[model samples]
Structure formats: C-alpha cells, structure tokens
Target: MTIDPEASPPRPPGRPRSREADEAILGAALDLLIERGMGATSIEQIARRAGVTRATVYRRFPNLTDLLVRAIEWEYQNTQPEALSWPDVPAMIRDWAGQLSVPRSRRLIRRLYGTVDDLPELLRAYDTAHGSHRGRAVRSTLEQARTTGQLPPHTDPETLQLILSGAALQHLAAYPDTTEPKDIEAYFLAVLRQVGFPAASPSPSRRSTQR
Candidate 1:
C-alpha cells in the first residue's frame, strides 16, 4: 500500500499493529461516521463493528476523536489519485470529477462538513492528508499553464487556486445531489474558465477515456 506522508507516525515500540485489524477498525469508523454521524460514533461501537476487542482499539488509538480523524484520512488516502503532481489541469479535473460523483463520497464529505464545529479534527485531518497537497499540485499546474499561455499572463495562480477551491465548495452546496461524472466535469471546467483558465475542452475520445 502507498504510504501517506501526512499519516501519523508508527505507534511506539511494542507489539506490532495487525494490518487486518487496522483496516477493519478504520473501515468501521468510516461507516459509523457516515451512518451515525460524529455525535453518535463511539470507540466501543467502532470496536464492536470492527469485531475487535475494546483493548485492541485502545492499543491502536487513544480515543474516539483520534480514531475518527484517522478514518477520514484513510478514506482520502484510498480514494484520491496517488499522484502528487498532475501533468495538466484537465487530468486533475477528470480525477476530481470522478471522485466527487460517487454518492458515498458526497455523503461522506457532507458528514465531514457537518463536523466542523463539533468535531474539527476530522477537517484538520482531511486538510493534512489531502487539501494542502492538492492545493500545491493545482498551483503548480496553474503555473505551468500560465507559462505555456493556457492561462493569461497576469493570472495569479494563488488567487486563482483559492477561487477555484471556493467555487467547488459552492458547487457542492448548490447541487448536493449531482452525481453524474460528465455534469460534474462540465461544472468544474466552466468554473475554471470563469477564473481565467482557458484550456480547451476535452475531445470526445479523451472524454470517453475519462468515463
């Protein structure tokens, strides 16, 4: 499995954590978070759902908060594209559209957003695991685009990044049930153009490949 650079370091020296048990625990936590939300999720429930002893969970994570944080991080690590750098803007857009189109993914994201005040750690974990990294990758791609004239000379990648990210969040709120990949792709591409990214539309063949 690919390691997450932002993932917490290995546990202190002692007994090794079972990979199977870890997966089970994380998976259970995620399910409970989506099904029950943060307020109702507990370590005992996670342990029960994971089919592991409370002691087994305590041995791995100290509390419910830590376990849930790790669960969100694990989910992102599994779902996101592994490449830290994208070759181009359209590739990034394609990958993000596919990710956003999953119903479970949309639900999970909404659940995470609902945790902002009551359970800030989940969002923090997400930012650490993917948000910051994705921002850098997108900025780098925008820089390349500007140099290559795909974007206007005066286009500020940093400002544009913020705008693009905000637009995505706005879109998620505006159309919470949108699950069609092509529709999601079109929305993002339009947002990109509105923000001054002038990359041409994907050809029919490229669109088919993305599907």
Candidate 2:
C-alpha cells in the first residue's frame, strides 16, 4: 500500500496531563502569592512546592501573570461568596464579612492589592475574569436598594459602590485584628449607615445571633 504524500502524518501518543498536577500548581501559586507577594514569589518556588517540573508549569501556564491571576480566580471561586446577585445590602455585607473573616483570605486580598503597581497585569486579568459581572450585580443590588428606600432616590449606585469598597479596604487596614464575622458585620453596617445607606434590617436569625 502506498501512503499518499499529501496525507497528514500520524500523531505520536503522549502522556495525558494530570489533573492532580494542575491543581497542585495552582494551589502552590496561590499560597505563594498570599505568603510572599509577587515580587518575592518565583516560578521556581511554585514548581518546588507543587512537586512539578518548571517545564510542566510553563506548558500549562506560559505566562506568570496568567498563572497567578488564574490561581487567585480559582481561590475566589472556592472561598468567596457564591451568589451572583444579592437581594439586599445586609445579605451582601454578611457574605463579605464571612469571607473576610478568614485571615488567609484577608492576606490574599492584601497581596492582590499590593501587586497592583508591580503586577498590574494580574489585576487586569482578574477584572477581566470576574469584576465585570460582580460589579453589575452590585450596581443592580444598589438600584434595588434605592427603589426600596434603603438609599435615597438620588443616590448614585456607582459612587456608593466605590465608597463602600474603600470603606472595606480601610477597615481592613485599621482593624486587622477584627476577624470575627459578627464584629466585621457590625463595622460594615456602621459604615453603611454613616454613608446614608439605611440598609434594611437583617433577618431575625442574624439579629438574635449577633446579640
């Protein structure tokens, strides 16, 4: 039998990629980012921690920024609030408090922000991946609040979002020790009230539990 000269060559059989190695690399990248920040963490460290070859990591994530950003996104998917839309400010605040209560989570957040100037690509990638949808959801929640009189009729959802976001970051800096969910919730509620948020009352369960 004569092989056609124009026919494509047969592909060589190669080893299939390991899910475990992929997970290990991602987890190592996230942990390094949280512990050492971008400046201090290196691909070599990640590879050593992940027990994978540097070539393997490069094959999976050709870009360092992409690797770190993907690792952060993975962490958020696993640890952050799950709801795409919140019904009220209190619910959103509670979820935020719950996630921020974890010291590791707070450290990760700080590291991400710290890398803004050094590794802006990471932030840009993250915004591209998750910020747009979450931002729209937040604005919609604020609009619902305005409609329900939780906010003033003239309240600008966009501005309020910026203020609340700044408040949370400031709170993190000012009261790093305040890791308890109830305490964080109280602090956020106070900030909201000060900003004329007038959020709807939390559920009876939360009220009783807080007390």
Candidate 3:
C-alpha cells in the first residue's frame, strides 16, 4: 500500500522546534553586540543572522532587550574562566587578571561598557546576572587571604572587591581599541598594586611572596 506524505502525523506547525536555533540566535546576538555595539543590533538582524524566522525569534525572546540580556548572560556563563584554586591571595588575583585579559573577553567587556550609557537598563540586567556571582567569588578569595593573614588587619574584602571590579571595568573601557597583551597585563597589575598587591616581577624571588 502506498503511503501519502500527508498521512504522516502533521509535523508540528512549522520547522521542528530546535534548541540549536535558540543557541544560534543567542550567539549571533552576542557577536553582533561585540562587533557593532548594542545600539546597532536589532531583533531582525539577529533573526536573519541566526537563519530563523522572525516568529521563531520571538518564540525564544520577547524583545530585543530580553534577547540581548539573555545573550550576554549566556556568553558570560559559558565563557567565564574556570575558577582558580590558588593557595593564596596574590596568585588568585594574578589568575583573575589573566582571565580578564583574554582577547574575546576583553572585547565583550569593552562593548558592554561602551553601550552602558545608551542601554542603562540592559547594563543593569547584565550586572544583576553576573555581579552577585562575581561578588561572592571575590569575597571568598578575600576571606581566604584574611584567614591566611595575606591581607592587612585593616583590609576590608567587600570594599576591595568593589574597587577591583570597578577598576577592571574602567580599564577595559579606557582601552577598547588597544589589544596589546602587555597593556592588558599592566592595567591589571596596576590595579593589583593599587589594592596592595606588589607589582609582578620576572623572578619569583624578587617579589615578596604573599602566601
């Protein structure tokens, strides 16, 4: 017996729902933001670049801002450097600095800062998503340092954490166009020194090791 194509249970309304499409849309949104900045990115552009219909895009994201926030969050969650497990404070700070200096991460951060004034709400969303987690990590690292006596008696982890985070953000904003590896390293080291970590030295013995 010949079977008719229509006889196949009508496959859900249109192209089968695809998780891949959702990821593609999010990825495209992130790439566009980094390349063109938030003001120039639109839902239509995301849909087109993601190879999905506008309706499909809407099915995943209600609006451009929502998509943008999700895209940033997704990228942050997936791209965050693996948590460092250094035995002491200075090493942890150095590891954090190295992670932040990664080229793609630096670009994403610079783009985010560039759009902050125009998209305050989106920036707020981004902060709310990443800030809490980051704060906790900073607190933990600082507390560990305090317990080990790596930090001075007067040092406050919360205040220092805010300073470090703000400084790093500002540094990225200040040098969005310059991708010099040494510049990035120097910026972080400057912040570290400002916060009381000694300037990094070529020879380990030249620096007062903070363990």
Best candidate, TM-score? 2
- Highest lDDT: give the candidate number: 1
- Arrange candidates by TM-score, descending: 2, 1, 3
Off by over 4 Å in 3: 1-16, 79-86, 176-186, 198-211
lDDT of 1 at 205: 100
Off-target runs (Cα >4 Å) in candidate 1 are 1-13, 77-82, 176-178, 199-211
- Model 3 per-residue lDDT tens digits across residues 1-211: 8544533444466766677988999999988888888878999898889877677788768899889988877876753534534566666666666666676778887777777787776677667667566677778888777666566656788998888878777776665544555666666667656655642333665444654
Candidate 1 structure, TM-score to reference: 0.79
Question: What is the C-alpha local distance difference test score of each model?
Answer: 0.83, 0.80, 0.72
CA lDDT for candidate 2? 0.80
Q: Candidate 2 — which residues are off by over 4 angstroms?
A: 1-15, 77-82, 199-211
Over all chains combined, what TM-score does candidate 3 have? 0.73
Q: What 10-residue stretch in candidate 1 is worst by lDDT?
A: 2-11
Model 2 weakest 10-residue run by lDDT: 3-12
